[model samples]
Structures are given as C-alpha cells and as structure tokens.
Target: MFAQIRWRLLLSYLTVFTSILVIFAAGVRLLFARSLTQQLTDRLTALGQGAATNAEFDNGRLKVESDFIVQQLIHKNQGLEWFNLNQKSILKQGNIGLNLPLSLSKSPIQFSNKNFNIQAVVVPIISNDNGKIIGYIRVSQSLEEVDETLTKLDLILGSSIIIALIFSGFSGVILTRQAMQPIEESFQRLKQFTADASHELRSPLMAIKSNAAVALKYPEKMRKSDVEKFQAIVSAANQMTHLTEDLLLLARSEKKCDRRENSVNLTAILSNLLSLYQPEATAKEIDLKSETGEDMYLLGNAGQLTRLFANLIENALHYTLSGGTVEVTANLVRSYLIVSVQDTGAGIAPEHIKLVFERFWRADESRSYWKGGSGLGLAIAKTIAQNHGGSITLTSQVGVGSCFTVRLPSVKISDNSQD
Candidate 1:
C-alpha cells in the first residue's frame, strides 16, 4: 500500500512539473518571437522612410535618386520597390520584385512565398512644395534567418525541458518515498497493535463463552431469567470472539509475506463447501449448487483458500431471497482457474460496488446486522485472493443478480504426485 501511495505521489509531482515547464517554455518562445519580429519591422520601416526622402516628382512622374538605392543595396536580404502615385511600379532594387503591390498603410504588412516569408513596410512620399502624395516606397526583408534562430531556440528549450523532467522523475521517487515514510510507519504500528490486541482478547472471550455455555447446560438450577441472561452472555461473547478473530486475520494479512504453500485442489474444496452449505440452502429454500471442473489445482494454503470461497458463498447465501439461486462455478481458462459465486439476491447499487471490499462496509446495514454479519467477509476474501497472486471482481445490477469472480494462477500436477 505504501508503494502504491509513493507511485501516485511521484506521478502527480511529475505531471505538475511538466505542465509548468511547458507553460514557461511557451511564454519564453512567444516573447522571443515577438521581440525578433518587432526588430525586423522597425528596420523595414526606417529603410522605407529613408527611401521616401530621396523621392521627387519630375514632370508629374515619381523618381528616386540613384545614390539612395546604391547605398541601401549593401544589405544582403533587404528588398525595395517604388511605385508612382498612379500605383504603377517605378523601380525594383535589391532582391524585391516589380510585381509587388503598392500599400498606402504605414504599418508593416507580411507576405509569404514558396521560398521565404517577408516583412515589409510602406512609406507614402508627400510633395515638399504642396504636401500632396507623389509616390510610395516599399521596404522589405526575408525572415529566413529569424526563423532559423527561433527554431534553434525551440530545440534548446525542448531538450532542456526533457532533461529536467528526467532528472525530476528520479528525484520525485526519492522525495515521495521520504514523504510517505512517516505514514507507513504509523500504519505498521496500528496493524501491530490490532494484531496484539486481538490475540490478547481471544482467551478471555473464549473463557467467558465457555463458562456461559457450561452454566446453561444445567438450566434447572437457575431461574428462567438467569438462564436467559447466561444465553445472552454466550451470544455476546461469541460475537466478540468472531470479531476479534477477523481483526487478527486482517492485521496479519496486511503484513507482506510469501504465500506459496502446498498444492490444493479447488474442486474438492468447493465440493466440501457445497455439502456444508447444502443444509442451509435447503432450510432457506434457495437453490445452491456447484458447476466446477475436476482436479483444478493451485499453489496456496488450503485453509486460506477454503476461507476465501466460504466467505463468498456465505455472503451470497445471506443476501439471496428464498427460492433464489446461488451458483458456484469453476472453470480453467489458459493458466488461470476462474471461480465465480453468483447469487440471485438483492443486488448492490452501482455506487456501493467499490465500497463492497472495504472493511466493515455493509450495503444493507440493518439487514446485515440482523443476519449477524460483521461486514468483513468480502474484505477478508479479497485479502486472501491478493495474497495468493490473484484478484476478485464483482459485477451486478440492481434488479438482476451479482457475480463475484476469483481468478487465480493454476498449477498442473502429474498423476504420480500427491497434493
């Protein structure tokens, strides 16, 4: 249980760490991208403004000075295009094309082609004499280098996040284990106390029950009221004894231990249990029967296995209505033996299914009390199945019946060998 808790804690830590790292990386990437884009846009706007300075209207036609174009060609990736006020291209310089359209808007407008993305700004040339629009200058640059730099930044951030997560995963395991140590110690101490207390109470409980039984054996010597009092004492002691025994079993089962024992035949065990329960079924007028294969064997303690199935059977019989069916079936599938106890009973609600195996959890509380159930039967059965490297599952509906299936790893034996 502590191991399971540690794993869950470590997973939660890693999940939260990964989320924060991803968000931080994304924020860094977004800010860096925006800063680089802003720098490109500013450079384009400045170049377009400078080109607009050298513009002049000659004979109502726009023209740009040759000196400005020559000086601006030093920039390798930069491009420029000039257009007359009529929106016709006047000149193309550097790497820009004449096919580029004129833009009256002062802000940068982005364009993309098969080769690369372009960031451009348009500057409208106003006549110095009359302040009338004369021409337009478009300055642009390719975004290849900026894209390459950002790609490299992405790679670096991604690799860093992965490495950090790998390291954090290792540390998370250690941290979660350290964190759970106190809780684990406390749980172990509680189990020890329960085992010790249950063991200590057994003798006194049995003695009280025995003394009450002996006193009741000679009922004529006592008044009728005293006889009733002794009978009540015997019943109370028996209940306490059963409760203590269950508590002790649960406490012991919680301790990790190897459970492999002698080979046990499941078929014979179920047969015996069926015979034992047959009289109760007859009295209740319920149909209790077994449909099982022969010589189904598993490596486990015979007593524990018997107790596991007995609990299931008793639980089924207790809930089932008179004339309802309780069927115990066993079948071999692959290397596992599947045994199921199905009952046509007052089926458990869907919400209560998960709580069925919890210690002292009863679906029908008042009915279980009247039926003398301590509410630990299913829990004990689950513990025993888990100890033997098996699992038990339940399937039920409210109006239909319920099935409790136990799947255990089966063993094969030769004819000459004795179990």
Candidate 2:
C-alpha cells in the first residue's frame, strides 16, 4: 500500500512539472527564433533600400550617386551587389562568387556559399521621373553567428531538463514519503487502539460472566429478582464479548499472517451456509433456497470467506419478513466464481445505498433498527473480499429487494498442484 502511494505521489508531481517545463521551453525557443530572424531581415532590408535609393539614370546610363554602397560593405561582412534590368551584375563586393538571377522580391532570401550562409533582400530601383524600373540592389548578411547562438541555447535547455528530472525524481519520492507520515501514524494508532481495547474488554467481560454463572448456581435459594439480575449480567457480558471479538477480527483482517490461504470449494461453503440458516428461516416462515453448483473452487482463507458469506445470508434472512424469499446462488463465470445472496425484503433507499459497506453505517431512511444488527457485518465482508483479491457489489431499489454479489477468482483444474 505504501509503495503504491509513494509512486502515485511522485508521478503526479512529475507530470505537472514536466508539462510546464516543456511548454515554457518551447515557448521561449519559438520567441527567440522569431526575434532573431526578424532583426536580421530588418537590418538587411534597410541596407538594400538605401543602396537602391543612391542609384540614378544619368543621360541614358545607370550610375551610382557616390561610393556609398562600397563603404557600407567594408568591415560589415555583408554582401552587396548591383544588377541591371538585363540580369547582369554591375558592382559586386564581399567576394560574392554566385551569379544568381535578378529578383525584385522584397522578402529576405537565403543562399549558401563557401565563405558565408547569407540572407539577402532584393530592393527594386524605380525612376522617380518616369515611375519605371531602372535596376536593383541585393544586400546579404552572414547567419553563422546567429546559428551558433541558437545551437548553444538549445544545448543548455536540453541539459537543464535532463538534470531537473533526475534530481526531481529522488526529491519527489522523499518529499511524498514525508507527506504521508501523518496518515501512516494515525492508521497505526487506530489499529493499536482496536487491539488494546478488545483485549481490555475481554478480560472484564469474562470475569463478569464467571461471577454471574456462580450466582446462578444458587437460583433455588435466591428470589426471582436476584436470579434475573444475575441472568442479565451474564447476557450483557456475553454480548460484550461477542462485540469485542468482532472488533478484534476487523482490526486483524489485513494482517499478512492472518491471510494464509488454501483452495476452498465455494459450492460446499454455500451449501453449508444454507443448511445452517434453514431452521431460522423456517421459524420465521421465510422461504430460504440455494441454487449452488458443485466444485466452484477459489483460493482464500476458509474462515474469513465463510464469515463473508455468512454475514450476507444472515442479514438477508434477518431483514426478510415472514413469507419472504431469501436465495443463495453460486456459479462459475469465466475466470471468476460468482456468489449472490438475494432477498425479497425491505430494500435500501437510493440516498443510503452507497453507505452500505461503510463501517457502523446503518440505513435509517425508511427502516428502524429493530432487526438488531451490529452494522459492521457488510464492512467486514467487504474487507475480506478485497484481501482475497475479489470484490463485492450491490444492486437494490427502495421498494424492491437488494442483491449482494461477490466475485472471486476461480481455481482451475489445471492448477491441480495444490491437490
């Protein structure tokens, strides 16, 4: 149980942490990539536009206004080239070795050469006097530095994520363990109190019954009032003893040693339960029936499984009115052995149905407690079923009766090694 709790706690924390980290990392990387590309494009576009503006058509020949384009290319590591409308280069700098076709495209275009990976924009040169095309200017910027920076940023994010996960795994497990300490301590205290209280009550209860029995031996010499008093004390002590035993059983149900198991034939068990309750059913004028199959076997502790079914049948017969019907059925369904105890009696209301298996929870929605129940029978049955790797479920309507179904993993004939 603690192992399961620990893993669940760690996984839950890591799920949220990893998701946030992944989203934040991706978001930051995306923003950085966009900003880098935009700044580079903007710088290349401004230089291309300035070069285009410096050209002029002088007496039917295109000519630059000054050495402005050459000055901008020096020491900047940016490629600058001028092209006539005939797609021929006029001025080339920064040792650009490619003779690409002329393009009047405003967007940045990327190309690679031996010296640099370049992003260039082609700005159109228009004659202000005639509003016609004259020539073009191409400005290119090197992307080596930008690529190196982004590569370093990616490596840092990847390394950080790996380290964070490793450290968080260990720390998350330890922190979760510390968080569960209070619950573990409270559970231990509850079990201790139950065991100690039952032990304490049993001793005094035995003494009271022993003294009462001694007094009862002299009933002939005593008045009616004294006999009644002793009888009451003995009866009360017996009741208290039974209650204490039940409490002890509930407390120890989860112990590993108490769950020592063997193959048990549920068919025989159900038959035995039916036979045991037959007389009570007959006296109450109720119809008790069993439709159990033979050799319906399962692996479980015999005593606990017996108690599980016994409690269900007992409750069914207890709440059943005279002339009502109580049925116990056992059958094998696929890999599971199913046992159901159904009664035609006062049923549970919808509001209280979910609380049937809760400890000490009795349904008082429409019924009274005249049919004396300890209210722990179903709770004990539920625990025993779970300990045996089984489950118990219920189906009931308020006016109609309730059915409690238990499913246990069936023992197959192929597993006859236990025989």
Candidate 3:
C-alpha cells in the first residue's frame, strides 16, 4: 500500500517541478530574445546617426563629403544607404541595395535585399541651417551571425532543461521518501501493535470460549446464573476473536508482498463461498442463489479473492431479514469482472452509505452485538479490492434493498494452466 503511495507522490513532485521549470525556461528564452533584438537595433541606430552627419544636400542632390571614411566606418559588417525625401535611394554602400523599407523608422526592422535578410534602422536628416528635410540614412547588418548565436543559445538552454528535469526526478524521489518516513514509521508501529494485540488476546479468548463451552455442555451441574455468565463470556470472546482476526488480516494487507500470478476461476470461488453460506441463509428462511454466467478467469491471489467475496456475501446475509433473497453473480464486463452480492434486507440509509466501508463504523450503534458484526467486514472488502487494483461500491436506500458490487480485473487462461 505504501509502495503505491510512494510512486504517486514521486509523480506528483515531478509534474509540479516540470511545470514550474517549463514556465521559467519559456520566460527566460523570451526575455533573452527581446534583449538581443534591442541590442542589435541600438547598434544600427548609432551607426545610422553618425553616417548622417557626413552627408549634405547640394544643388537639390544628395552628396557625401567623406565617402571613403564612411565606407571604412561601416566596415564589412553592415550595409549603408542614403535616400532622398522622395523615398528614392541616392547612394548604396557596403552590402545594401536600392531596395529599402517603405518609411524611415527610428526602430529597427527586418528587410530583404538582393542577397540577405537584414536588420536595419533608418534615420531622416534635416539641414541644420534651413531646417528643411534632406535625405535619410539607412544602416543595416546581415542576420546570419545573430541567427547562429541564437541557435547555439537554444542548444545550451535545451541541454540545461533536460539535465535539470532528470536531476529533479531523481532528487524528488529521495526527498519524497524522506518526507514520508514518519508516515511509514507510524504504519509500522500500528501493524506491530495489531500483531502483538491479536497474538496476546487470542490465547485468553480461546481459553475463555473453551471453558464456557465446557461449562455450558454440562449445564446440569451448574446454577442458572453460572450458565448465563459462561454464555456471556463465550459471546464476548467470539466477538473479540472476530475483531482480532480482522486486525491480523489488515496488518497483512499493509505489507507489499508479491501476489500470486496464477489464474483463479471466479465462478468456482463464488460458488463455493455461496454454498458455505447457504445453510445460514436457510436457517434464516432467506433464499441464497447464484446467477453466475460463466467461470471467468483472472490473474490474482485466489485466497484473497475468496476472502474478499466472503466478506461481501457474509455482510449481505447478516443485514438481510428472514425470507430475504441473497444473490451472488459474476460476469465479464469489458476489462473488469463485475461481481455483485445483493440482498433484499433493511437497506442502508442514504446519508450513511459513504460511511459503510469505514473501519469499525456501524450505522446503528445500538444494534445487537449477537449479530457478530465487528463492522470491519466492508472495510476489509474495500482494502482487498483496492489492493488488487479493483473497487467495491455500495448502493442502498432507506427501506429498499442494498447491493454491494465489486469490480476486479479479469484475465483468461488455458485449461491446462496451473491454478
């Protein structure tokens, strides 16, 4: 049981960690990209502004005073161009062409020229003396280098994310294990207490019941009060015995033991269990019957399956009144084996339906103790079903009958296979 809980804890930790990491990584990537783009645009703007200073408008024509120096300033890294106010390119240098953006924008833009995709910025020049608009200077750089750098960054970030996920998964397991230590210890202590209590209590209970039986058998030699006292002791011991046996079973369920892989026939196990309870039903004037369809097969522990059904059937029989009908049925429903133990008894109240499977919980606290109900039967059934990767549910009404359905995983085996 703890093993299952452990894995679930591990997965939950991984899921939360992964979600947080992914969000952080995405934010980092987006911020990094925007920063890089802004840095490139700032560089282009600086160059474009500087180049505009060396330009002038002469005789209604654009001219540059230092063409060679401007070429040297641009170097081989970027393209430079000058455009007239009419949106026509006056001069092209470096890796640029006559093709430019539709307007001169202070911000950088992506544009395609004859040869490359360029990140460029355009700045308009005004004659300082006349305050008239002259021409615009466009400065640009090819995006191949920026693309290469960003690609390398992506690879680094991707590698970091993968490594972090693996580390988190490994560390999460260890951390979750350490965190659950207290719970595990508590369960171990409880199991030990149950084992010790059952072992210690059984001997005295057996002794008391044995002495009571012996005394009651020879009632002629005893007073009426003595006989009554022995009978009470016998009854109390029997109830204690049932409670202890149930505790022992619950403790066994705590261990994560490897289950049997052999196939068990549902039809046979239910049939045998039904036959064993038939006499009790007969004595109560109840009709006990089976509506089993076929001998469905499954891979599981036969003993546990037997006990699981036994608890359900016994509970049904106990709750049902005289002349009630207790029915057992099983069949294959897709991937599950639906086995139901139904009874036409005084059904459970709607409000108490959910509490039926709780350990030691009884709907009617004042009911007779002689009914032999320790209130752990449905709880045991629930544990067994869940441990087997199955489930049990109860449906009841105030005055109508009750039905307890158990769904277990089913399998098929050849006739010659081992039991």
Q: Pick the candidate with the highest lDDT.
A: 1
RMSD per candidate (Å) reads: 2.9, 7.7, 6.0
Q: How should the candidates be ordered by TM-score, best one leading?
A: 1, 3, 2
Clashing pairs in 1: none
TM-score, each model? Answer: 0.89, 0.64, 0.69
Model 2 backbone overlap count: 0
Candidate models: Cα lDDT each: 0.85, 0.82, 0.80
User: lDDT value for candidate 3?
Assistant: 0.80
Segments in model 1 whose C-alpha atoms lie over 4 Å from true places: 66-76, 96-107, 130-132, 257-261, 365-370, 414-418
Model 3, residue 271: distance off in Å is: 1.7
Candidate 1 per-residue C-alpha lDDT over 147-184 given as tens digits, one digit per residue, 9 for 90 to 100 = 99999999999999999999999999989988999998
Q: How well is each residue in 258-360 modelled by candidate 2, as lDDT tens digits? A: 3234677778888888889999999999999989866777777878889999999998988778899999888888999889999987899877878999887
Question: What does candidate 3's lDDT look like per residue over 1-419, in tens digits?
Answer: 67779899999888887888778878887888788889888888877777888888889887776444546645656878878888887677774553635576656788665665678788877786687779888877887677777788788878988899899888888888898899999988988998889878889889988988988999999999998898899988898999998888877765543445577888899989988998999999999999998778877777878889999888888878788899888889998999998888778788888898888888773223336777787888888888777889988866568899999888766732548
lDDT of 2: 0.82
How does model 1 score by TM-score? Answer: 0.89
Q: Evaluate residue 194 in candidate 1 and report its C-alpha lDDT on the 0 to 100 scale.
A: 89
* Candidate 3 stretches greater than 4 Å from native: 60-81, 86-105, 110-118, 128-133, 142-144, 174-186, 205-239, 253-264, 275-290, 296-303, 314-328, 332-375, 382-419
